[model samples]
Target chain A: MTGPRIALAVLWKDIRLDLRTRDRLGHMAVFSALVVVLLSIALPTPTAETRPWLPVLLWVVLLFASLLGLTRSLQTETEEGALAVLTLAPCDRGWVFLGKGAANLIALLGIEVWTAGLFSVFLGLAWGPALPEAIWAGLLGGVGLAALGTMLTTMATSARFREFLLPVLLFPLALPVLVIASRATAEALDGRSVPGLWWGALALYDWVFVVIPYLTFDYLLED
Target chain B: MSAVETQEVEKRYGPVRALRDVSFSVPEGTVTLVAGPNGAGKSTLLRILACLTRPTSGLIRILGRDPFRKDGPALRSELGWLGPEPGLYADLTVEENLAFVARLHGSDSGRVESVLEELGLAAMRHRRARTLSQGYRRRTGLARALLHQPRILLLDEPWNGLDEEASERLTKVLQRHRARGGTVLVAAHAVPAARELADQVLRLEQGVLRMLPGGPREETHG
Candidate 1:
């Protein structure tokens, strides 16, 4: 009925749909844990010297895991011709984009909440005065990710190697989210003072970068 | 009320022109079947009207509101569309899928169950969309298009994959809607159900749209 109400409806449908069979959160959790294990073994951080690196590494792994989920939506969108149905609706295509972005942002945040908690415990990483700061970092990262991921996923539906294309294309667009998340995370985890500039920097990228994807999403969804 | 109007509508993909100087108007509350061979721009015209595709050039309005002014959602609040092979989320049960769209349009989920029951889809409420046959899935799309009680309905190839019963059901629904002063536009592969229901027929070919000579007449296409 209302704009946000419509968005929530889409989000609920996606969540309920995912819950019945695939378990998006569970899949992301497992994938994230696997990445965490791999990172732990690959880097040889026996003395906890790589502790500051924990925040960044885990976030990177989680980012990949979220991408894994985002990439998977392509098959469903194509098979269902959901894009066609969505485009054909009397509502604005931007609402469709925004609805999807909000859904993805929430889902990614769900994964981050769980993965961050477990990752901290396993990595023996401590969050000091920057504990709350690290979370804001995570939220910004998730917001930026949802904006770009939905835009690209719309394109990947038209592509042949969508899964491969998502990460390959995303690797560049996502560098900003990565740099900000990791730097703020590194500062927070190491018990260093979180810089005022980094927060502003992440927020700037969030607003500025999102506008491009938001304004252009409808074109990508079209034939 | 005029249901739709387009002036100098042209859509192009780079150098190729898909729609050329398409100007047309349809009287309100009529079943205007857009018929043509493949690549006749029928689908393109429907997309522009549905506000899904923007014309590379021209002015168009749905119920008199400019559809391409970047204020589309405002216009979309009252529009309904059924695309060819409208895909539902495979993992969702039929009921869940229905309720989801209903609520998305700010309607009640209970109405979804009732609508499904009315459409004889009650028993399969828990069934996944991927599990339904082609005909039933199209029914799901039809149900969603009918949600929100839209004043305008745009269906692209509405009769594909339907059996006699489903076809009859859809015809009845359209007849009821038309009787209520609602406007219906159908892009059908063949003439559907009763010939008496159409107020006008349109033939699309070679990037042009024109009215068929006979009003609401039966057309037998081989």
Candidate 2:
């Protein structure tokens, strides 16, 4: 099969599985909702001083929520040694990586939208004014997270402590994405234009992760 | 020419050697039975041959091409592997699983129906894999492996969960494959039917490989 065809096959398969089982996405959604509910109850009323911190808080929630989904993304593939079937793809195994990463990207994007809505409903946050820039930040941040998370998850899938290993490996590498994304989000919330530097940084981070995984998946998918 | 060949193929998992200088060759249009006790490296050898894992220090060629090189992915397309696990998606129905594999191999979607019928899985095509019995799961897995009509089949304990009828059906499938000039390498503890159909018999003990005499084809190897 051609590269894109392989990727599409994997993408559709994962999506279909996710829809059928609702295991990964369902867990992530519930976790995010519970965390948001706790934050709404525990935090002091949203004041002008604390309002700026919301962007950081939002990104942090996303990171953790993404961790929930990313950790389980390969469960289906690993369940019955199905990963062996994926390794048999006729194209570069990198195409398989792309397919998996794309599926994760879609899932993360869905969670981002859900979390944003939850924040608006419970935290009394207004997103109307910041919609465009916030979307750009969310898109770039989601891409970086999905690419890095998918690659690291695959690498750690066979590890004994994979559940613990993913976060340890992910948090450090994902710091830049969180920093730049939160800053952009903060500016957008304040109705200020996000500087091009943050956008470039997010884009660069995404590119590096996507390219590295694409180049190294052949080895990552092997024993 | 040999369809599968390995030279000094050794596999090590931290201090423990799973395969030790195991070398063997399987000719085209033949069925080779590899028998061994549990933890006898039967699965490891099959995984190596299937290109699922690399040999620590050896050479492996599938259809005359190094399966660990740049050609490995393309070469893997011609191979159908059924490992200890069925390698299926539990939530997907039997038909969905087979269709997915067919697409991965770029095979005609029509092959999915044909394989289901051939494997007697058509009746349960709409059933989720997780809901099927073990025997049916194995049949579905075999169907997935054969979906693309691969030139080589690497099956590990394929008859484990098969009923007598399913076993007979599998025997026929192997016969048909051999008749079509395909190569088959099956790893198991002991399957009388497999022995009856085998062109060669190789025994693996403690990571060592030896050819059993009296087979139609035999080769001396370490």
Candidate 3:
């Protein structure tokens, strides 16, 4: 009905669709688990000896898996013509970006949870500075990833070779998130309570690049 | 209720002029049909009115608001659009798709069911949207656009995949919507066979617009 109201509705709709299919988010989980498995095989044993790298490993797995879900996020809307419908609503078009961004955050968070669980289980991991740091890093990293991923996804929707394009475009942009996530996570794994400067940087990136979609979304949706 | 007032509006796409010095006024509670040849700017005009794109230079107003500046959540509650795709969620069930938009507009409970029935999509309510025929898919888009009960309905090729019966049903619903003071701006190859449903006809060619009388529309029916 209103901005926030419709924003929530769009977010809910996107999540329901992705969650219902199981394939989209399912692929994200599977891809995430595979990464965890691979990391376990490559590095093997996640006792205190390997725990130092656990935070890095956790974020690496999540950054990659987030790709699978984000790429297909706007694919359905573009292919099905929902973008046009959304643009036609009396509300501003930015809500489509915001709504999709929120939905993406929810899905990415879901993938992260799965990846974290698998990492701890299969990698023999159990070490962190504090619960707050872990959650803060996760939320910060999750929000940044979703913001960057959602805009890139919208851009990819209108481009040629979208499947290839989304990954190429997303991987480079998400690199910063991975770097910050690794740093924040590394500090936590070492049991050294520290200021989350990486999270701050991540937040900075959100404000800059994520804002690109809103300012230009109308241009992108035009036929 | 005069819904749209555009004065000396000109739209150009980079080097190509989509619309040249175009202007028109559309009153509310009436169905204005737009017809044109290829690259004639039918879709371009629709985009401007929907506020998805801005004119290169001109003042265009819709229901007393500037669409370009008022967008997304602010504009969605009142505007309804059906473009070439009506792209419903391939993975979502028909009813779920309707409810998704319904819930967004805070009208989920009975809105989804009513629109589903109106579009004759009741039986396919539980079916995945991708599983439906082209006609049904189009209906879903139309249904979703109207799901919010918007004041202005900007539809592009809305009848692309509908059969006679479905077309008639859509026509009936539109008549009721128009009767209730809702404005309909349709971009199509030809006017709806229900000529009485049309209040005015506008044509575009080579970046210019020309008005066609109501009589020319009657010949379209025959």
Candidate 4:
């Protein structure tokens, strides 16, 4: 199979596996919802001053939930030794990274949508005109998260305490995506115009990470 | 021509060396059984030949091509590998697992059906791999590896979980593969059936490799 075709097969296989077991993606969505409820209970009512924190809090929850999705995404492959087959397949190893990233992107997007709907109802904030902007920021940020997370996941899979190590390694590297995404999302939620800088930074973060995984993933799988 | 060749290959993890000065060659259309005790580096050698790991400091080639280069995956496409782990997706049904592997090799579903039948897994085709017994799971892994009809097979401990019947079945399938001029390298502590099919047997111990006078049959049968 060609590179993209192999990637598509990987994506399809992951989707089917998710549909069957509902393991990683399901945990992410449910975890995000739980965080939303718990945080809402802990905080005071959403006043004009407190409402800004809502977007930051939402992104925070999504970010942590995304970590779960990323870590578990490769767990299945490792469990069955399937990564060996994937790496040895007659396509560039970068395609495996792309396939893994795309699958995580789809799973994270599901969580993103779920969190967005629930946060709106719980915080009583109207997306109004900012819904589109917020969505764009979320999507751009999701791409960055998935791309970097997949690379880090592959790196940590060979480690002893990968579950603990992935977040430690991922947070610093993923700082750009988080910072830009939070700022853009907060602006949209506040009904203020988001600066072009944050969007550009998010896109740039996505671009850098996407290219990096393509280049370094071969070594990561080299073992 | 040699189907696999490694010259003084070495694999070191920190201060410990897993493979040291390991050198061997398997002729095409033959089976070589790798015999060794625990920590003997049999798995490491097989992993290198399967293109799953690169040798630290030696020349290694599969089908006469450097497997650590850009076209490694292309070269590996013609080989099948079954590691110690079953490597079958637990969430996927037996048929799905075979089909998925076939797709990865750009083969058709017909191959998947044939392998399932060949491995006597057709009845359990719809069962999830996680729910299968150890023997069945091994069968599933074998089916996946053989689905593409690869020219070479790299198997690490193929006889681990098989019952007598399943083991016999696997030996027959492998004999048929060898009859078709496919090369096979199997790493195991004791594989009597494979020994019967093997033209060469190698022993690895403490990161070193040495040739045995006879096939593994001499070691196990008598």
Candidate 5:
């Protein structure tokens, strides 16, 4: 099969599996909701002084939730050794990585939207003024997180302590994404323009991650 | 020409050596049985040939091309491997699993239907894989392996969850594959039907390979 075709097949298959089982996506959604609820009850009312912290809190929630979903992204393949099918693809294994990463991006985007909605409803944070910039931040941030998380997740898939290994490997690498995304989001929430540098950094991070995984997936997928 | 060939293939896992200097070749249109005790590296050897695992040090050629090189992915398309696990998505139905594989191989849905019918899986095509019994799961796996009409088949303990009738059916399938000039390498403790149909027997003991006598080619190497 061609590279794009293989990727699409894998993408569709993963989407179908996720829909059928509702394991990874469902867990991430519920986890984010509970965290949001706890924060709403614990933190003081959303005042302008505290509102600046919302962007940070939102990014943190996104990071953890994305981590949650990323950790389980490959579970279906590992559960029954179905990853061999991917390793045996008729094209470069990178295509398989693309498909998996795209699926993860989709899942993360969904959670980002859901978390945003929860924040607005539970915390009374109005997003109307900065909706467009916030969305841009979310899109770029989602891509960065998805790219980095997917690669780390695959690297840790065969490890003995993968559940623990992913975060250890992910948190440090993901620090840049969190910082840039949160700052851009903070600016957007403040009704200010997001600097081009932040966008550039996020884009660069996403590009590096996506390219590295594509080049190395052939080895990563191997035994 | 040989369909599968390996020379001094060695696989090591940390301090443990799974396969040591294992070497043998199977001619085209023949069935070769690899017999060994558990942990004898039979599965490891098949995994290497399947391109799922790389040998720590060795040379392997499938259809006269090095599968670890740039041609690897293309070469893998012609190989059908079935390990202990069915390698299926349990949430998907049997047909969905097969269809996914077919798509991976750039095959059409017609091939999926064909394999389903051939394996007597059409009746349960819509049944979720998780709901199937062990035998049916294995059947579905076999159907997946055959869906792409590969030129070479590497099967590990394919007879394990099969009943008498299923075993007989598998024997027939292998016979037919060989009849069509396809190569088959099966690793198992013992399958009477496979033994009767085997063109050559390779014995692996402690990661060493020996070609048992009575085959057209005989070789013993450590």
Candidate 6:
């Protein structure tokens, strides 16, 4: 199979597995949504002045929730020893990373959408003209997060304490993505223009992560 | 040329060495049995040969190509590997799992059916792997490994969960594969069926590999 075809096959398998089990995506949606609801109840009602914190809260929730989806995606491979089969497939193993990242991009987008809706409902914030730009930022941010998450998660799979190690390794490497994404999001939510610098950082982070994983995925699979 | 060749292969995890200076070769059209006690590096050796694991320091050539090189994927395509874990997606049906793997190999649907029937798993094709018995699950992995018609087979414990009939079927399959000039490297216990089929027997203990004299039929593990 060609690279794209192999990647699509892997994506199809992941989608099929999720469809049948509903294990990872369900956990991600519920865990993230719960964070929003719990915070809404715990925090004081937001006014125009304090509402910028909502964007930060939203990114935080989505960030941690993404951890669950990312880890589980590779966890299934390790738990079932399917990683061997994937690495053995007649294609660049990076294709597996691409397929995984794509699947995660889809799942994270779903979580982000629901979380955004819930954020608006709970915080009583009006999206207004910022909605489109915010959506754009979120999409861009998702690509970077998904790409980085896919690579780090695979690295953590062979770790002794994968559960704890994944976050430690991911959170540090993910800081740049989180910082840029959150700032752009805050600017959009505050009805200010997002700087080109922020958007450029997000795009650059996404491209670097996507390319690095493709180049280095073979080493991660190697023993 | 040999289907598999390894020279001074060693694998290390932290301070522990799983394989040490392991070297062996399996020429074409023969079945080589790798016998070892648990934790004796059988799985690690097989993993290296299958290109799923790279040795810390060594040379490995599968089908005369270095699996660590750029053409590794193409080399892997010509090799079939079954690890100790069954290596299947439990949520997928037997047929779905087989079909998905076949597609990854760029094979058509017809190959899937033939493998299913060959393993006597045709009737259970639609059943989810999680619902099947252990034997059936192993058969599913075996079928997937064989579906692409690889030139070399690297199987780790192919008989561990199989029933007598299924074991017989696998033996026959190996015999046929060898008759057609395919190479097989099997890591297994000293089962009679596997022993009878092996042209060579290797024993591994404490990260060392030794060739047993008198071939598989006459060799006995201590």
Index of the highest-DockQ prediction: 5
Model 5 over residues B103-129: C-alpha lDDT tens digits?
899898899988888888889999999
- Per-residue alpha-carbon lDDT of candidate 3 for residues A1-223, written as tens digits (9 for 90 to 100): 4667667778888877776777678889888888878888888555666676777778877877888777667666776877765665445556777888888898888887788778778886554445567777788889888888887777777577888888788888788878887777767767777575666787888787668877776666664
Q: Report backbone clashes per prediction.
A: 3, 0, 19, 1, 0, 0
lDDT of candidate 2 at residue B154, scale 0 to 100: 93
List residue ranges in candidate 1 displaced over 4 A.
A46-50, A74-78, A84-98, A121-123, A127-130, A155-165, A210-223, B108-110, B192-196, B210-214, B218-222
Winner of 2 and 4 under TM-score? 2
TM-score of each: 0.88, 0.97, 0.86, 0.96, 0.97, 0.96
State model 6's lDDT. Answer: 0.86
lDDT tens per residue, model 4, B1-222: 789888999999889899998877788888888888999999998988887877889998788888888767788788899998887788999999888887778898799889988999999999998899999999999888888888999999999999999999999988888899998899877666876877778888888886642543353221
lDDT of each: 0.75, 0.90, 0.76, 0.85, 0.89, 0.86
Worst 10 residues of 3 chain B by lDDT: B213-222
Q: Considering summed lDDT, which 10 consecutive residues are worst modelled in model 5 chain B?
A: B213-222
Candidate 4 regions off by >4 Å?
A: B212-222
Candidate 6 - CAPRI tier?
medium
Question: Residue pairs in steric clash, candidate 1?
Answer: A1-B106, A80-B87, A90-B76
Clashing pairs in 5: none
Report lDDT (Cα) of residue B142, candidate 2. Answer: 96
lDDT preference between candidates 5 and 6, better one: 5
lDDT of 3: 0.76
Model 2 chain B weakest lDDT span, ten residues long: B213-222
- For model 4 the local lDDT of residue A209 reads 91
Give each prediction's DockQ, rounded to 2 decimals: 0.51, 0.83, 0.51, 0.75, 0.85, 0.79
What is the alpha-carbon lDDT of model 5 when measured against the actual structure?
0.89
Q: What is the per-residue lDDT of model 6 for residues A98-143, given as tens digits with 9 covering 90 to 100?
A: 9988988988998999888888888776778888888888899899
* Residues A1-223, model 5: lDDT tens digits: 4999999999999898788888989999999999999999999998888898888898999999998898777687787778888889999999999999999999999999999999999988789888988898899889888988888888887889989999998889989988988888888878889899889989998899999999999899887
After superposing candidate 6 on the true structure, give the runs of residues whose Cα lies further than 4 Å from its correct spot: B212-222
**CAPRI-style docking class of model 3 based on DockQ:** medium
Docking class of 2: high
lDDT of 1 by residue, A1-223 (tens): 4656665666676666566666666678789887776765676654656566677676788778878778666566677766665664445556667778887888899888877777766666666566787889889888888888888888787677877889998878888888889888888766777789888888888786567766775676666
